[model samples]
Target chain A: MAKVLMKGNEAIGAAAIQAGCKYFFGYPITPQNELPEYMSKELPKNDGVFVQAESEVAAINMVYGAAGCGVRVMTSSSSPGIALKQEGITYIAGAELPCVIVNIVRGGPGLGGIQPAQSDYFQSTRGGGNGDYKLLVLAPANLQEMVDMVQEAFDMADYYRNPVMVVGDGMIGQMMEPIEFRTPVKRELPSKEGWATTGTKGNRKPHIINSLFLDPQGLEDHNIRLQKKYKTMKENEARYEAYNMENAEIVLAAYGTTSRICKNAIDKLKEEGINIGLIRPQTLWPFPEKAFQEIPETVKAALTVEMSEGQMIDDVRLALNGKIPTEFYGRSGGMIPTPDAIIDKIKEMLGGLK
Target chain B: MLNDKRIRIIVGHYGSGKTEFAVNYAMKLIEQESNVALADLDVVNVYFRSREKAKMMTEKGIKVISSAIGHDANLDLPAISAGIFAPLQDETCQTILDVGGDATGARVLAQFKQIINFMGYDMFLVVNANREETQTKEGVLRHIEEIERQTGFKITGLINNTHLLRETTLEEVLKGQALVKSVSDETNIPIKYISAIEKVAQTIPSDVDGEIMPIKMYMREEWM
Candidate 1:
């Protein structure tokens, strides 16, 4: 297939359909509205279902209901809307149902303006909803990755029987770039016959798709099983990209839109004889902490740059384990830090280390 | 300048390929003459607007007025740049106003009604017969009516720019041209151009009624 120019949100939506997601439920939210809008128009034509739910709360519940029926389903929203869907998300997690959730994150802490922001890092990577549950979050920096990740997310969700989040921001959601959709891969998945609630057939036992285990012991057993699955995810699914780390004295840690900026800053620093490298965590959950170990012994420090108030910095700190000094710089409330700004912050941090 | 209008404003449905047409049209204007200014009056849409190509346009000496805050920023807090008015007031510059999509987006045009009226501008409705919303002559007419009613600017001409993303064929292009031609016949609006992909436009028979504009599909889907 030939490459086409597409907005990130629209490409992600098409990618979801291409991955065999037949049901979509979402609410309108800026920076991510195009996803729902595209699905609303395109999904039905493909014999897929698209419901513009009354609210974010309703939309997520719809996702839960559809996923329980063994159909591939998805729901997307921005920050505040995602916050509303968290309770449903936790319920979906607890039930061990597979579904794809996309959060084209925006500035937040409470409706904090609509430009791109990575403030949702802790909310996404850590359990935002109440419970010991984790979403396999994929952070894509460009439109092509945005398209690829959403398609891969559906498979990951079914593979683990857990929700997979394709995390991006307004920059990833609204930007237009050339992308070619790769041919859909045939992924092996667990048969839905055993678990899906497809209504009672002849001699088989009815499948009960519910998170409620009234008995404390039963709930504990379920939680333990879920934990075991998460352990497997942690062991296998952590993904990261390294750039210019051949011989670096400084490492920059970032993800999604901020990661792209860091890459540019790293190139600019290289021209100035400053060997700055970057470690971009493609998956926010099960973060590629191992990449930090690859930071050369010559490296004196690591700087975490973000569009939030240093949320990902904690992960960098945890990854490095104080073997080397780690510092943070960021801008929040929809303010995007430019490459030059990142370079200055890197210089300041390196100056301090020296 | 198909209709000899100094300021050509392109309007259409959300996915009607308006931005792509506007970009190609702006490039054509620049190729023909020097003083060209493209105003990104599309405050309604956050993506795929002419502003995304501002650097390319400006590098070629074409003045561009887009987002005041940041480049390619989808900020909901729309702050229209004041420089948009300079081209409107200037007589020499061949200005192109790329308005946002649909009736609600056309509401932004009301802000420049007074200046546009005083300056005498031409509004062209770009139609994509392939779009689900405007697949027939009735649908096309209804959309045109709705856009005109909302924007309060009667469209002066029609631009047929139908396509199935990058999968468009010569047959589909001709089918779309026929639909838009029916619309032109019914409404008496001049068919300014029938936009076809570069390959299709080259092969279009000379007997085709309107001017054929060979456009590269700048706005496209992932799997072309």
Candidate 2:
């Protein structure tokens, strides 16, 4: 219950330990490198496994190996590194393994740059690696959310029997902000005796965890079955945050760092008598499209701002359709606009509306 | 008014040759026996930037103000100072603040704006296309407006320093000029100068009688 100035990476590492995630395998990368180091020290003290794999691919498979045994496990890396792990992530999804993967995303398109960017919104939600699969991806805006959701990710992974990911970028990884750690939820981890690949417990059948269903129809059925779970997630788990939305004439839609900036813009614009609000998505996978749909008719426009050229903006425009004129403001690759800069756009657009 | 030591806010998009602009600007000013300095204020970008050129700036006596060498490449990079704020107020000839790619990165400028304005300093925001964020006129205007808001300072004009590092083509400069013209018409701010990585400063079109920055300090010292 103490307020500590911890980076988002360190907070997630601590939360993982609290959540009884006894295994972590990750490759070292910038912004989030503190994570592996923190876990290296924290996990072993709690009698956990912290394996530093040679590559991102190796790390996620290590996660697969650990999750197959029904012990809590996780892995993390940045954007380019995550691309390398997608193959193993696909396997983790296909096998219906419960694990947590953290992506402290950096800019990209191929080792683009090491700045905070939400360019991975599409990659995390729309399946970056392969197959018709959905990874329960959570976007935490602050250090507190980073810790809360890392713990929540474990619970969600177990509840749904699927993989979960914490998709953030450099801002979340490196920024030092105040955080309050969650009381480690002590739950009896699900029983592994039935199918977990642990040694035979009292003459039980030999257990195996593999995604090799050779029959095409059988694979189709499995994928369709997975689709049902995704449907459930989409229906029940979409979450977002709104500020001063009741009296606003326009809405600023953003996620991650831009979303936080949008909050500042909304407050300053509101002070100047321009009614504005913010919609910040917490779950990027089960994206809170319904939240926008619930906006009142008094609200006319939504401006989608992101660090990418237009990844999340496209999603916003799709969510609103023609109900309102959705506009977009973006600074792609590795650019971040000042708070005043975003407010200026809202001011310009508000004048246009007038 | 020839105080080169005042803070020169050199703003630009990523990969738009802002680092090189700071380099040549410092080099030219240094050779002129001006007490010049530079500060790497670009936080939201990593690699192939002005930080890579830190050693060279020091060799030429260009004091580069920055926080924690090899620190996080981010927007909130701590505002570092070498006590140059005092000297630049009256004595020094030029001091350049090589700010980050877009508005947020330039928001760091807000921290120092009031002081600089009070001390009679000038600011120039750099524009480039080959960069992802500032590829359009609208994007450029948004960035310009954002920087102005954050720093409480206005960019008098634009510098179309559009180049692809070593592989910059002449055509990109021409297209960049066209983009600058659109911005000029909309905001009424003249296109100050369009610099090339090769240090080529061509004749300004009739409407633009902007000053030329005829220096490009890369691997050598020969003028093309």
DockQ of each: 0.19, 0.04
- What digit string (tens of lDDT, one per residue) describes model 2 on residues A266-316? 777777887887888999889899878888777878899888878887778
lDDT of 1 by residue, B13-34 (tens): 7667888888888888888889
Q: Please write out the lDDT profile of model 1 over residues A16-65, one tens digit for every residue.
A: 99999999999999989889988998999999999999999999999999
Best DockQ among the predictions, by candidate number: 1
Give candidate 2's error at residue A143 in angstroms. 0.4
Q: List the residue pairs that clash in candidate 1.
A: none
Error in Å for residue A346 of model 2: 1.5
The fnat scores of all predictions, in order, read 0.22, 0.05
How far in Å is the alpha carbon of B74 misplaced in model 1? 8.0
